[model samples]
Target: MRRTHPANMFVCECITQSLFRLMKRKPYNKITVTDLVQEAGVSRNSFYRNYQSTEEIIRQFLEEKTSKWWSEFIAYPDRYPHVISEMFYHFLDMKEEIDLLYRAGLSHLLMEHIVLCGRQSLTGELKGQLQRHQLMKQNVTEDDSYEICY
Candidate 1:
């Protein structure tokens, strides 16, 4: 999702939540824009303004959550072990969404997002910690690190 206005942000969240609710009642592949907008109590235009597809909703939610977690992860002076522990707790905060994805057979979306986030987060600060502690092998790929971390 783009940087939305405060009001449209509300709509985006509403739509996202509604999608999850609908997924609980039906398969993800069975949901549609009409179903989402109706469930969210928003118009089609509102949904279109924020998301192009249902999968985009899940991806965007994961993106926002990942960004928030990364910001907090880097803001503190905690060691890599503590930060890694916190990362699990941080994502546990989204247990509902994660469970819903699994129940809806959309785990691939979560995996894709995690892989992307893992690649992006292996930057200067965290990478240095991994190297210094010998926590990560030099040849470890992004996917390997993601698997290790999770």
Candidate 2:
């Protein structure tokens, strides 16, 4: 059955919290859907209704965080001067989640999300803006800038 929006969000939040909590105590690879559901106090069917895999959970979390960071990053008028530092600080704020990702051998998902966020920029504005701000003052192409990021 289809869940109401709020109910779905509640289930998602429960599962996410449970996953993070479990990650703190065990290897992510060792945690199964049964473990997650039990920890979340949610039904296995509820977990499956919102996500297909544990990786999807992490991916969704990363996407939400990076997307929010990008939005807030763009809102600052003096963003260019401190963009790099701000980016690092933003990630630092998510250190726990990042640590979990690293411990889980899922660090690649972080890079993937970064690339995805870059691609989502308006008409490559993210790359172009960074280049204009001397991010790649060495005359690197947009594609090359991405390589530098990677």
lDDT of each: 0.77, 0.74
Tens-place lDDT per residue, model 1, 1-150, is 454678888999999999999998989889989999999999999988777789999999998888867766555434445555766687899999899999888899988886676675576676555555655455665556463332
What's each prediction's TM-score?
0.80, 0.78
Off by over 4 Å in 1: 77-84, 124-150
> What tens-digit string does per-residue lDDT give for candidate 2 at 40-142?
9999999989899999998888776777778765554245465556667878989998988898888999988776655554235555665555543445554
Highest lDDT scorer? 1
RMSD of each: 3.0, 3.5
Consecutive 10-residue window with the lowest summed lDDT within model 2: 141-150
Alpha-carbon error at 91 in model 2, in Å?
A: 0.4
What lDDT score goes with residue 77 in model 2?
A: 22
Model 2 score (lDDT): 0.74
